[model samples]
Target: MTAPLLEVNDLKMHFPIKSGLFSRAKTFNRAVDGVSLSIQPGETVGLVGESGCGKSTLGRCIARLYQPTEGRVYFKGNDLVHLSHKALLPYRQNIQMIFQDPMESLNARHTVGEILEEPFIIHGIGDAQSRRRSVAKLLDTVGLPSRSATRYPFEFSGGQRQRIGIARAIALNPELIICDEPVSALDVSIQSQILNLLMDLQQEYNLAYLFIAHDLAVVKHISDRVLIMYLGQIVESAASETIYQSPLHPYTQSLISAIPIPDPHRKTNRILLQGDVPSPIAPPSGCRFHTRCPVAEPRCSETAPSLLEAETQHDARCLLINSQ
Candidate 1:
C-alpha cells in the first residue's frame, strides 16, 4: 500500500489567556485538543463540524501557519513541528493554503499579475519577463482574462477574486492544499463553481486536499473520507458513503440529520442536540460531547472513550459503540 503523503499525530493548538493584574495567571484555550489523521496522494479528506469546533485552527496547525503547542506533523516522513521558519522554506513550496475570504487574503496594493508572480519571485523561479509570462498563463488557467493581470482585486466579483486566490495556491505546484472553508463566503451559485474549479485542479495536479467546512452537504459532495469533529476532537471517521448512510457516534448522527434534503416532499427526522457547546478553555470531563448527547449515560460522564474501530476502516469514539 502507498504511504500517506501527510500524517498528523495527536496535534494540539492552545492559546493562553491571562487575567491577573500582573497578567501572570494564565489559562489555555484548548482549540485543538488532539487530532490525528492522514491524507494519501491526490485524495480529499473532509473535516466537518459546527462553528467554534476548532476545524480552522486544526487546518492552520497542519499548514504550519500556527506552530502547534504539542504533537507531531509529518509530511513525507519529515516532522514539521520543530522546523524553524528558515528551515521550512522548502516544505512551504509543497504546501499551500486557500483562505475563506479572498479579499482579505489578497493584498490590495498588488495587481493580479504581481500577486501571482510573488511566489515565483520568492522562490527565485524565473526572471522578470519570464515571471510576467507565467502570470498571464496562470490567469488563463483560472479562467480569468489576461487583462485581469493588471487589475486590482477589488475590481472583480467575489467569485473572480477567489479564482485568483486559487491561482496563487497552485502557482508553486503544491502537493497538498489546506482549503479552509474556501467556498463559505460566496453565493450559492458561486460556491459550486469554486468547488468544481478546485476538483478539476486536483485532478490535473494530483494534489491532496484537507477540505475543512461546516456544511455537511458540501463535504459529502467532495470528500472520499469524512471525519466528524466535536469540541476539538474527532468523534467518528469512515468512508463518506458509510458516514452518511450509517454514522456510529451520536454527534455524527445529529450533524448528518441536519443536512437539508433537496426534495420538498421527502420528510426526515432531525436529531436535535441539547445544550450549547461548552467552552474549550474548560471542556467537560470524560466525553466532551456527553453534555449534549441525547442518549448519554452516567458512564459517559465518568470515563472518556478512545476512538475504536467499529468495522473495517470505520472508527468512532463513544461508550455505546465500545460496548458492542
Candidate 2:
C-alpha cells in the first residue's frame, strides 16, 4: 500500500477570548477540537461543512499557517506542529494553501508576476532570470496569457485572480495543497472552469488536495473521498458516492439532503436543521451536533461519541450508529 502523503492526528486550534480588561479571565474558542485524517499522494479529499465549522482553521493547521494548539500534523512522516521556522522551510515547499478569497490573498502592491515569483524567491529555487521564465510559464499553465504577469490582481476578474492564486500555489510543485473554499466566491460558470483546471493540474503533477468547501455538489464533482464536519469535529467520512448515497450521521444526512437537485419536477426531502450552530467557545456536551441533530437521543447529550468505523472505509461519530 502507498504511504500517506499527509496525516493529521487529533488536531486542535483554540483562540483565547479575554473578557475582562484587567481580570485576566480568558476562555478559549475551540475552533477545531480534535480532527484526524490522512491524504495519500495524488488524491483529493473534500471536507464539507457549514461556514464557521472550523473547516478553514483545520486547513490552516494542516498547512502550518496557524500553529495548532494541540496534536500532530505529519507530512511524509515528519511532525510539523513543533518544527522551528528554519527547519519548517523545506516542508513549506511541499505543502501550500489557496485561500478562499483571491482578492484578499494576493498582494495588491505587487504585480502578478511578482506574486507568482515570490514562492521561488522564498525557497531559493531559481535566479531572477529563471524565476521570470518560470512565472510566465505558470501563467500559461493556469490558462492565463503570458501578458497577465505584468498586471495587478485588482485589474483582473475574480476568476482570473483565482487563477493567479492557483499559479502561485503550484509554483513550488507542492505534494499537498490545502484548498480553502477556493471557488465559493466565483460565479457558477467560472467555478466550473477553476475546478476543472485543478483536476487537470492534479493529473499532470500527481498533486494531493485537501479541498474544503460548503457546497456538497462541488465536492461531489471533484473529490474521491468526503469528510463531513460539524461544529468543531468530523461527524462522518466515506467515499464521495457512498456518503452521498447513504450518510450515516444525522449531520451528514442533513447536509447531503440540502443539495439542490437540477430536476424541478422531482420531489426532494430537505432536512431543515433547527437552531443556529452553538458557540465553539462552549460547544454542547457529548455529541457536539446533538443540539441541531434531528434524531438525537437523550444519551447524545451525555456521552461523547467516538469516531468509529461502521463499515469498510466508512466512519461516523454517532452513538445510534454505534449501538446498532
Candidate 3:
C-alpha cells in the first residue's frame, strides 16, 4: 500500500511564559497539546472548532510556519520535524498555507502580479518573462482578469483579495495547502465564491487541503472527513457524513447541533454550550472538553479519554464510548 501523503504524530506547539525575575518557574501555553493526523493526495480534511481552539496552530505546524515543540511530521515519507532550514526549502514549495485574512497576508506595497510571481522567484523556477506570464495565467486561472494583476490588495474586495491569496498558494503547485479559516473573513455571498473556487482549483490541480474553519456548514459542503477540536485537542474525527449524523463526543454533538438551518419552517434543536472555553494556559486535568461537556461523567474529570475508534471508522475522545 502507498504511504499517506502527509503524516503527523504527537505534534505539539507550546509558547513559554515568563514570571517574576527571581522566581524559577516555567510556564507554557499549550497551543497544540497533541495532534496527530494524515492527509492523502487530493484529500480534503476539514478541521472544525470554535475560536481559539488551536485549529490555526495545527495548520501552521503542518505547513512548518512554526516549528513544532515535539513530535514528528512526515511528508512524502520523510520526517520534517528535524529538517534544517536549507533542507526544508524544497518541502516548503510542496506545502503552502492560505491565511485567514488575505489583506494581512498579502503585502500592500507589492502588486498582485509581484505577489504571485514571488514563489517562482524564490524557487528560481523561471526567468523574468516566464514569471510574468505565469502571474498573468494565475490571475486568469483564479477567475480574475489578467489586468487585475496590476492592482494592489487594498484596491480589491475582500473576496477578490482572498482569490489573490489562493492564486499565490497554488502558484508553486503545492501538494498540500493548509487553508486557515480562508473564508471566515469574507461576507456570506463571497464566502461561497471562495470555497467554490478552492474546490475547482483542487479538482484541476489534485491538491490536498487542511481546510480549517469555524463554520460547520462550510466544512460540510467541502470536506471528505471532518475533525472536531476543543482546547487544543481533537475530540472527534470521522467521515463528514458520519460526524454530522452520529457524533458521539458531546463537543462534536454541540457543534453539529449549532449549524444554522436555512429552513425556518423546519423545526431543529440547538445545543447551547455553557460557559466560555477554558484558558489554554491552564487547561483542565482530564478531558479538556469536560469543563463544558454537557454529558460529562465522573471519569471524565479524572482520566482523560484517549482518541479511540468505537464505531467503525469513527474516533471520539469520550469515556461514554468503548475504546479502540
Compared with the true structure, all predictions reach lDDT values of 0.93, 0.93, 0.90
Q: Please report how far candidate 1 places residue 234 from its true position, in Å.
A: 0.9
Q: On residues 24-136, what C-alpha lDDT tens digit does candidate 3 reach at each position? A: 55988898989999888999999998888899999998888899999899999899989999999999999999999999999999999889999999999999999999999
TM-score of 3: 0.97
For all candidates, what are the clash counts? Answer: 0, 0, 0
Supply the global lDDT for candidate 1.
0.93
Model 1: ten consecutive residues of lowest lDDT: 17-26
Cα deviation at 294, candidate 1, in Å, is 0.7
Tens-digit lDDT track for model 2 on 1-324?
688999999999998887877766378999999999999999999999888899999999988889999999999999999999899999999999998899999999999999999999888888999999999899999999999888899999999999999999999999999999999999999999999999999999999999999999999899999999988799899999999888899888887787779998987899999989899989999999989989999999999999999988999999999999
Instruction: At residue 65, give the lDDT of candidate 1.
Output: 93
Better of 2 and 3 by TM-score: 2
Candidate achieving higher TM-score, 1 or 3? 1
TM-score between candidate 1 and the true structure: 0.98
Runs in model 2 deviating more than 4 A are 21-25
| TM-score, one value per model | 0.98, 0.98, 0.97
